[model samples]
Target: MTQTVTTSAVRARASSPALSGPGLFTVLLAAALPLVDFFIVNVALPTIGADLAAGEAVLELVVAAYGVAYAVLLVLGGRLGDLFGRRRLFLAGMAAFGLTSLACGLAPGAWWLVGARAAQGASAAAMLPQVLATIQAATSGGRRARAMSLYGATAGLSMVAGQILGGVLVAADLAGSGWRAIFLVNVPVVLLGLVLAVRYVPETRSPRPEPVDGPGTVLLAVSLLTLLAPLTEGRAAGWPLWTWLSLAAFPLAAAAFYAVERRADRQGRTPLVPPSLFALASLRRGLMLILPFSVGFSGFMFVIALALQRGAGLGPVPAGLALAPMAVAFLFVSLSGPRLIARYGTRVLTAGAVVQGAGVLLIVLAAWRDWPHLGFGSLLPGVTVAGAGQALQLPNLMRIVMSEVPPARAGVGSGVMVTTQQSALALGVATLGTLFLALVPHHGMRDALVVTLLVQLAGVVLTGLLSLRLPRTVG
Candidate 1:
């Protein structure tokens, strides 16, 4: 009986189509777009506000809308890819993303940009899961290892590059388009991605795709929206009555969603996020680390961009370039992650968290001392160490999360993981960004920046503690 099962598995492996070299590159390029857009708007927000005559309230919406939409719909997007062809969904989503990006660039007002950004986020949700699913289904052994490592590296680098590139684009004001150039730039890249995808990317889908979990999907959506919406918009909108009510409803909605999903799993039906998936120790523990790391990372990005530009009185180029050392450190360190993991195991993550925490503290000290005079040189040491430490954590954490997820359930697994990461990102912006903003009026910009960095340092420490629980040796 065991021999027969082994033979069947071997035959299934033989029949799977491989993801070619160019195909892998195309999907990685696609993966980079959504993450890049998430951070790209940070440095450009001031310009966007001026050009559109948008207030702080409306400006927050521009970022929140996209993040909420992306986080809420990601799991559903993955399931759809499993039912339909991954390649088909990838192409369709890419087309929608391009169109929405065009709308964003052409938007005549603040509300128009917000709506377009939400649409763009939805499109990203549809496209990104397929990249991970394809990599899981199409590659194996050393090839799979290499591909996964590259995907992790790409994810980290793209995030840093997004902010850096945004600063440059806003400063350049190409074709006199100003901040709009940031969104408009995606148009040409998406067109190129679509062409490459069609010619090189292979189609893949689940062998026995389950029907969509309608109840679970709706409940999950409710749970996320109720929690995220009010938190992101509440302070900006003067903490309206609706925000409090929404916050009150969140726990109930979350409880209901969990109960429904659990019941569905027990009855041998597939839920949107399978309860069984977390049985993988690597995935479960790795995700815990990812949540805190992503939250702190995003919050720091948003706050630092604002602080350098407003408090330190730097131009967009200088504000963005202040983080250049971090980006360079991340890029170089990430290239060697696979080798480090092979030798050091999960210890890399713990040490990374310590290193990152030190960097955050250094920045806090700099802010306290330098105040309005903080520049690229003054901020160099902290950002470089922070970036190097982050390089160690994010890529390895991602590889660990997906390490034990079954190839057959790759779409859902990737979706679950990305959703967790994305939700934390939104929360980071809402929570830490709000804290920083709230403090600025009372404590002054310098004090607020210091306090925010200290808070982020605590998060880094928590991430280190969580990393201790991850499987000693990842798959």
Candidate 2:
């Protein structure tokens, strides 16, 4: 009798509504908010500092605080979704995100803003994993592939648009809100998302959800903080003793985390991030590709933003507009990705790398020859090709990473993949951003920019090499 009842319950849950197109749109909209917020502040940081009398270190915290909190809690959020419900957490997270944005908008001081931003990051961590997990549970085959592609499109476009929109909002100064408008703008969008989510989004959760892995969770948090904290804050904070100590502790924490997770897997217990998940050729190689690609992608974004604004004397709007070519190219190419992938398989990623490399080399030459006169016209060819290449790479990689994930393990798989990307993003900003800033003082802006592009090209080359090792076709 007990076995019969359990099987019936499983069937009932599986028979629930699959994700409709409208529902997919709603969840993808939710996914965009966090990423947008992550990059939105980049352009507004100078304005924020001037208005709040914030120094460099505090301003860095404004960014770092949000990133650290978002990353640390993501895997836990995924597990929670599996244990309770995805739609439930989605609504809660969206509501919390709205309130936190309001707090950030109204904050009167630097520390207050930092606190609010940290809370906002926590809210995002709660929200983002459900997007991928929900899709994984609700869709299959071609539908799943298309949804993942759209999600990737939304993510890439949001990162670029956030900086663009931030520039516009800060300049527009709606009712004289200035930089606060960047955050305040999220309120209405979140409100709309909540309404749609309640109406259209289907509820989903793991059929055999496991209890939270406490030891694995703690070790993972320690491992990330020990590494990311020092790298992000070390230069601005004068390389304090504590920062060095944290850096030294990272490898130890990481090793311990791996050991614990492996032991749990060996014992047939589900860990926060199961070591067993990496056995999939697609997931493993896909992640290896994503790390280098993300590092280069974000590093280029940060370095270029600084170069255009600080060195070239362009205002925020113009600086943001400079990437319009890339944005447009990414959108068009990504829309066509499914068709391309159907025909060419994973070789598309290799082609993307070659195109992106060519674009980077073009940018390097243009910067070298044009110097401070660089503008939209001079950068159009390079940015457009690079954006197309990125379009080809990012969406397909995301689809590949989760291609083999079972519906029951969807939440864990999504969480692990996102955590890896988020950590790489933060690391990119720390390492590449630091390198660019450090070089500028000695080598000057143009030389520093060129050198940075060269380094990014090297990373792109590495990604191409790694792509060769992936299974020739995705599931």
Each model's TM-score?
0.97, 0.97
Quote the positional error of residue 174 for candidate 2 in Å: 1.1
lDDT of 1: 0.92
**Using lDDT as the measure, which candidate wins?**
1
Q: Candidates' lDDT values, in order?
A: 0.92, 0.90
Worst 10 residues of 2 by lDDT: 9-18
Across residues 420-453, which tens digit of lDDT does each residue of candidate 2 receive? 8888888888888888988999999999999989
For every candidate structure, what is the RMSD over all alpha carbons to the true structure, in angstroms? 2.2, 2.0
Residue 401's lDDT in candidate 1: 90
- Tens-place lDDT per residue, model 1, 81-125, is 998978999999999999999999999999999999999999999
Where in model 2 is the C-alpha error above 4 Å? 1-16
* Model 1 worst lDDT window (10 residues): 10-19
- The deviation in Å at residue 259 for candidate 2 is 1.0
